[model samples]
Target: MISTKIPFVIFKSFFNGSIRIKLDWESLISEQVTINMSFFEELENPSSWYLPWYLNDVDEEVSYLAPNARQLTLADIPKAINHLNSKRRDKIQELLSRFINSTQPVQLVIATYALPDGKHLIMDGNHRSSALILAGVKARLMVFEMFGPLDPELLPDLRLWKD
Candidate 1:
């Protein structure tokens, strides 16, 4: 069983002035192939803000939190999806198949911002996360706690886009 006592380590500081937390999930699912989170580099200079393309039309206001990251269980998945404002059924099932049939473990980098009421607004990786829930996989997500406006231009240090 994966220990819930995992310590939260402040990983590194990014160009956009945000610190990522280094989480150790190696022991959780040893059979799964580990893919290091590399989306941070792509976010440094995005040609278009549409990389995390799903949020383009979302009009909700996002709240900020201090840099925080933690492990979320399979049970927490549904609540996170609820923040998206719409349940995407087809997209989740499609990703679910990819997750179950793949020979290698798929590393999903789910990012979310904290809501004022202590809820999370999943900014990216919703489909993958939902699929993981359906697959009954307990995974560690690299959830970046964001602050400020949702506008790409107004985001802190041009590090607004997520995937």
Candidate 2:
């Protein structure tokens, strides 16, 4: 179950319109994709969506956290925030401020694909999602299953990107 906190009206429109279309992420990423402003404004509750990253209390390390590959909601934000240090918390605040002040549409890249359990693996945009939730702007995500846990490999891509 790909946990998503989408509004009823947008949900209806999403299935009925081009808002949520399935596309290849590789191709889609090349083109500039922006979430519609209406989508953000219509979110009923931004606090109910799930996030993908969490901090481990034992070693104080950050891990890619999820429940049975299920979605995490904004309701879970406080716990994640609480686990973070002052620096990380401050970053979230900065993102919230920028999101609130910007009139431009928020740019995002939500990598979606199916898991072995037949669940959808929603990856990327972890911090931005949290920031949006904190800013109280909600939007339904359009999921595209271009790849699973790995596209070119069998396990998670442990390699970090370098620009």
Candidate 3:
């Protein structure tokens, strides 16, 4: 049910003048998309919310690692969007309508699995990322590197991208 076995820690590093955060957590079980949604409540005003607020009810001992932030560009969006299913694609379209012409900078929590081929399998943030892409808005991504048993078959609508 996505319980953590240890306290989460955030590590910061400087790479080429940019800050990179590395988060390390243990024992996260990937679940179906709908089930995963229960872990975080939707914010009424997206701009007012930060990633940590979503985990307010989650036990501190089991926290998701927060890595440093990086810029998400237009070139990266299409590749990532290709990984989502039609259902998620529709949601992104919905969000696009609202986010279009939005000047507020977008920041997102992106979770991924590092693959052998150097690509990342996006385990979370498909909707937000997709919408941001459609709106032609660049974003700062706080990437969470997920380490555990992740079955793609369980989440048919995940996106894949190279960072």
Per-model TM-score, in order, reads 0.37, 0.44, 0.41
Over 26-63, each residue of candidate 2 has an lDDT whose tens digit, in order, gives 44344333322122223334443334444453424254
Clashing pairs in 2: 47-74, 48-73, 48-74, 49-72, 49-73, 49-74, 50-72, 50-73
Which tens-of-lDDT digit does each residue in 1-163 have in candidate 3?
1222221233112111222222222222223111111112221223222221111122111123222222233344454344434565578778887777567766666554444443444445546755765676555556554343333333221211122
Best by lDDT: 2
Q: What range of 10 consecutive residues in model 3 has the weakest lDDT sum?
A: 32-41
- The CA lDDT at 35 in model 1 is 20
Give a tens-digit lDDT track for model 1, residues 62-146: 3222133222333444444443334455677678888788665566655444333334444456567567666654344444544
Q: Can you rank all candidates by lDDT, best first?
A: 2, 3, 1
Q: Identify the superior model by lDDT, candidate 2 or candidate 3.
A: 2
> Candidate 1 deviates by what RMSD?
14.4
RMSD of 2: 10.9
CA shift at 58, candidate 3, in angstroms? 42
CA lDDT of each prediction against the hidden true structure = 0.39, 0.44, 0.39
